[model samples]
Target chain A: MAKSTIKLRTKEKGGKIQVKALITHPMETGLRKDKKTGKKIPEHYITKVVVEANGKPVLTADWSGSISKNPFLSFSYAGSKDDTVKLTWTDNTGKSDSIEKKVGEK
Target chain B: MKRRSFLKGSIAAGAAGAGLAAGILTPNMAFADDVADNPFKAKSVDEVLKMLGASGAESSDKIKIKAPEIAENGAVVPVGITSEIPGTTEIISITAKNPTPLAARYTFGEGAVPAIKSRFKMGKTTDVIAVVKAGDKYYTAKKEVKVTKGGCGG
Candidate 1:
């Protein structure tokens, strides 16, 4: 099972639910060489992020090795305050993480 | 100009704009009429557009990519994607020079601002391209971000 590596927060204001998420990952580009030993670093990155509310996806992100080590994303939608928001990510290496947050909880 | 006709015209324009931003009709589908699978899987920038079924993109004066001329560290170089083009429904970021140039892709819902802020890793200095999809067309802009320290396995 991949780790639950997402930190997410939601704010309800002015009839909209705003969401912000931060993910943790190495996001390494399969380049660079070891200084001590000559070997290339493996490429590892979170390639996709899907954000859903009440099972209806609102945002989907596709990324590459060029993304930062850890990525942060923020967006808002016209959703009910009682909706459940879920975030999930998958990497190029086949590892993944997912988390669920209820809007009114925070 | 007749008052009622003018009002109806503006309303129709606003509705069209909304329809354009709502390009991502479903959560699992983006540009529902254009694609069925993920286009970001594309290894090259051109493939991304092709995946989206875009006719073609042209250099534009409205798309803006904000990044440092010299990023102190490659680990997390902040980048801002802002498109002034009207009816922008999607934005695609490309590291035109990355080993695999298609960096990131995003779709905006109707009425949401067409601006994106994120960070990307730089293996070395490279030109960053931003492709904005507005209604049925695509526009592009680019900037060169020089990385002092290699972020990718450099």
Candidate 2:
């Protein structure tokens, strides 16, 4: 399983805090025909992604062959006390990976 | 000069001017035009959902996606996504109709962006739909970007 990790940090806000994350993957579409091989690359892409915070699920996405390689995502969340956000991804090839991060109040 | 011959000459000139105008407008129109007409041979979002077999979903307005209004090059158009929604979970996609609509899919581990940035090559102009799964439902937004003639070749 190819795993990933996210590290979240936020400035102290009286109400809510924002969080961000990044993932590592090839995200190959397998569409372009290789010049030398002269064959269409087999479809090997991330089909699903999941993100969780403090034991609660927050965001998820479905992907297609159009995504670029090594995708980078950023987002914000209402922060509370010590919270943890977890991430996981699965590809069409059935390969999956996961990682975790701790949220800190600034 | 013969009256009939003079009238005919003016008509020919008028036609040429109209033709040139059309030629110039064509390029501009192509830039703003969405590729829905030639949508990439892609699958429907519903079909992808069934294939992925996802369970949890969420919809939130906190998500925002930014890309160029008109991409000169369809080969590599940059896209960025940001979510203000709390407790981010998943991100999914589906182009109206492409060979394979599921674009780049990602999830957050710890310090992941409620957002993601990537470059996608558009065979033609089309709407890039970004669906963010938060909580237990799906929330989505889409923007149509025009893929004009690129440097590679039109």
- Could you say which candidate leads in DockQ? 1
Q: How do the residues A7-64 of candidate 2 rate in per-residue lDDT, one tens digit apiece?
A: 3344325544454445555655666666677666676767666767777765565565
What TM-score would each prediction reach against the true structure? 0.71, 0.54
Question: lDDT tens digits, residues A1-106, model 1?
Answer: 7556888898888878888888988787666667777666777888888888888777777887778887987767777778888989999899988889999664
**Residue A93 in model 1: shift from native, Å?**
2.7
Candidate 1, position B36, lDDT:
33
Find the 10 residues in a row with the least total lDDT in model 1 chain A: A31-40
* Highest lDDT against the true fold, candidate: 1
lDDT by residue for model 2 (B1-154), tens: 5997888799879986886666666776564232222222236655555544542334445777788989887666788777667765666555544556666555655544466655665666777777776676667777788778431122
Off by over 4 Å in 2: A1-17, A104-106, B1-65, B72-93, B102-121, B129-142, B148-154
